[model samples]
Target: MNALMLAVALATHATPVSLEDARARSRDNVQALTAALQASSAEQDVRASRSSLLPQVRFSAGASLNYIGPQRSYNVVPVEGGGFQQLQIDTPEVRYPFFNLGVTVSQLLYDRAVWARLEQSGAQLEALRGEATEQQDTSELEGINRFYSLFRTQATIQVLEANVRRSEQQLERARALFQAGRVGKAEELSALVNLGNDRIAVVSRQSQLATDQARLSTWLAMPGAEAVEAVDPGVLTQAPAPAPSLEQALQEARTRRPLLVALRQRLRVAELQESIANAGYLPRFSLDAGYQRTGPEPSVFFGQPARQNRVNGGLSISWDLFNGFSTQAQARRAEYQSRVAELNLQQSERELEGSVRQSLVALQAQIVSAELAEANRKAAADALVLAEERFNAGVSSTLEVRDAQLKLTQAELTLLENRINVEIARFTLMRAMGTLAPGEAK
Candidate 1:
């Protein structure tokens, strides 16, 4: 039996993970990965846009065959004395094969629109980078929340199991008293009922622990079939640090928040779009040069006498004199979009401020609640000891002891919950302030 119990313990044991470790393992989170991919794509777009500013070189080669149908020609032959004789001649089919190779290079001398597009692409890249950071922050926060949740459930289950053991002890005591004729069978039955209820509560708590463990494991990208255990960071015994002033928090959020930075970048992009749209009002200039070789044969080998070589260079200018008022419409649309981006930025700022304030309040409240719960737990423990003593001395009934045990269980669970909440609230405030990072508390 001892060996069987040891085997069960070993089988059920889970490896403990910390919040930081869990977050490190969560790099493959879908949202974060998606954001990273988008950022990479935007980086490619920036490269493409910048390439447009450089000279473009192209090489082309082609071979073609031409054929014409048989032709009839009339020739007038001068006779010996006068132009009186006409002669008919037949011509063979005309067929030829031609080959050409060319190299061309073009450079844009002036185009405000192309420059604006490059600037826009650069701004877009910055925006995507900010979004990627925001996604990472979000994923880290989620991992922290799950980690604490699992910790809380595990602690609660411990308390529940202790309560079940206390109930069992109370039932045994009641049976002893009834056999000694010091208490009635009713008291024993009540104790038995309490034990059953406590056991039921334990079962429920264990189920909850299982569920929370699964959730945390999934968030950490661990195998779904494996169990994950959380190690208590002992926040319950330590005092929470005071929260920063609301003004300071708001400043930090504005300065460091990834989403806000992204919005600002997007606003720049929109402004650049407006410039690009208006660039159409000006003319564009470019220089192009080309070299070509043409021959009747498909070979360009060293200086074939039949090959023809040509070189050309030119400056080109394009001006859109009219485009059915499309440029005007585009400029107007860009302006509206710029306005929209500004409004979105402002709204996000307001929302972020609100979140920071709310998190601060919650953190303060949880800290105070944790303090009170600690005191309550201590008092309940003393009460339980006294009740047990009175029951053993025959001065109090088993009911009093059971009630004390229940109160102590509640107190312990409450303290555990409040401590977990304090930690979570602290991290939440950090997230809202945009300072959340792996393994580090703001």
Candidate 2:
């Protein structure tokens, strides 16, 4: 199929579109913005993690009315008049109202676990950034592919339209010649058939172009995007150099894949988690201090009364010797998680190797295909010129000319396809090798 047919087949029923609009729409679309927000969320997570390590303070204050139930009787104090007589006692409820206020503060002291976790959070943040970048890369890559695809479809549509016009002109000439008795009924009939075939081809290609446009618009996230015209592929070109060496590409992937980096970050976090869990076995310490004043202190309604003042402070320590195996179970789970992270990192490395090899192989295939298409295109052009010359000289039939023309058009389309595919393959190789950035060129 010609480029337009390919595009139309790919698109929803629609007209053509311009390349610039498609890219612009994609950049401004929901997908791009969503990926950006995801990165920001990861950064916020890191900030929260860092904040966890900072000193925290809490204030406490409350007022209460207490109906002090019955005071304790004084132990035996002998009265001088009664000598050893039993002392009389009175028990009465005491009522008092007071307010208490204080502030408590705690600062992180020596916590190896905390330091490890902080570092882990930092790594995790970086990993998230990488993932967002990867997402952008995927979008951009798909955009490039769809963009060129649209170009091919537009080219094919042009070819089909031209062919239909040519066929109509041929049919008109044949009818005129027949009316003048310069051509036979067979010639007129053949021209009519050719015209019908060309019209059918034109209709099919047009339909296909519509489909390609719709698909492209959807990909660009421009739901309302209309038909756009594509520019002619001015000239064919090749990558500036042979594909980078396989070893070089593999190394790049090892360091570049966001998924791998994310796994590595998790591994670090798991190490930190394990450390934090182990810290449960160690003692923790805190300090508290306070001051208070009690007894009647010159109330607004009462004469000045004696008051008692007091101050107190203390250090506290805590340790958990054993749980019902809960802490131990948690520690074991963390260990298993750490192991999983390590395994993932290893798997990523292996896949990176395979990707590099596969990309190189695919790149080679495109190069060969492009070369073959180039040679075939030249041959088809020559054949087409010969067929047209023969027809104009009245030495060949219209059927022969049309067949040659079809072959020529098909060859050119194939060549166009090969060129675009080569570019796509190179782009893929760059991604596989990890050399391509995750975003548009700066």
Candidate 3:
């Protein structure tokens, strides 16, 4: 309730707020920092993957029961007294218990395309980092835009309310004149109708202002938030130097823009994938070691007997003989993907160039528009004063006075909106060139 009351109060006494302040408040938001964290985590994954190139060792120790059904041959050649002529018969299988221990070591020796994949992983990691950075910037830019929009709405609503008051005062004055037999009754009725219409406008604008405030709250993720206060959105002015040149903007984008960096990194990853695929046919080498021990105890060899340990170690190599051209096909596919990535990169470059140039052009136009709005607002103010003076002296009709008032009101609102639009336009240019400033994160 207190916040709402404060918001209502701001409707009447809003103060000037600088663009820098709004951006700073938005940056302090927590959401922005969360995005940065997500990016850092993704980069960590890439680092882990890259570390796979290092050698790895594993130790295995376990015990298992092994048994075959016991088997016996009736006609066995005995060393002492053998009966070769005896009928031969075989019993069931044999059973044994054994324990094994081994250690395994594997190293990523050079082969087809593993390096390429590692490089690709690095690129992917970089891309994700860039994505996070871009999101942070984009989120803040949106907040700034909403801030300005909210300010404009608040200002316009105030102007409309003022119009309503002015109309009411005029109606009162016209009624007095009519009662004195100085003006026709029709004039008073016209004033009454105008006042009603102005009041209606005030209500409509206030409704719009509420809607804008709700949207701003949602964007800023304000917790249990109240309606937005009307910010002053201070003077409408252009950056001192207007927009930077196209070349400079593009250069900045190349170095500073996250999306651009991400795209470039993705392309590099694709190239690495191509390399990895081509290397798929290469041979791979690995080392292994283990130990084995066997006891002469046939009783021990049976499932009920005790077991012994074993250790063994060896080096092994496997070279693929053929895969029916599968590897070749995969390499070709990777090559095609690499080409596509390169094309996309080129497209990004061209689009960025146009975007930067277009923003610069719009910024220049707003400068002119802002100056014109200022001059028009001043002229309208002067016109209203003169018309009011003439009507008081009985040298003008009510129609002239009303028209002058309407024109002046329109001019004032126009000037305020124009100021906001110009500010938004400057920020738009900043965003286009990937130069939005940092703000507080919640």
RMSD of each: 3.6, 5.6, 5.4
Candidate 3 regions exceeding 4 Å error are 1-41, 64-75, 78-83, 86-98, 175-181, 223-225, 236-241, 291-309, 438-442
Runs with alpha carbons beyond 4 Å of true place in candidate 1: 1-13, 65-69, 73-89, 176-181, 298-302, 305-307, 438-442
* Per-residue lDDT of candidate 2, residues 348-423 (tens digit): 8788788778878888888788888888978977886787677555676777767876777787678777777776
lDDT values of the candidates?
A: 0.86, 0.68, 0.70
Q: What is residue 281's positional error in candidate 2, in angstroms?
A: 3.3
lDDT score of residue 232 within candidate 3: 67
Worst 10 residues of 1 by lDDT: 2-11
For residues 354-422, could you state the per-residue lDDT of candidate 3 as single tens digits? 877887788777777777877887898798788767866667666777897898789888888766766
Q: What's model 3's TM-score?
A: 0.81
lDDT of 2 at 383: 84
lDDT, ranked from best to worst: 1, 3, 2
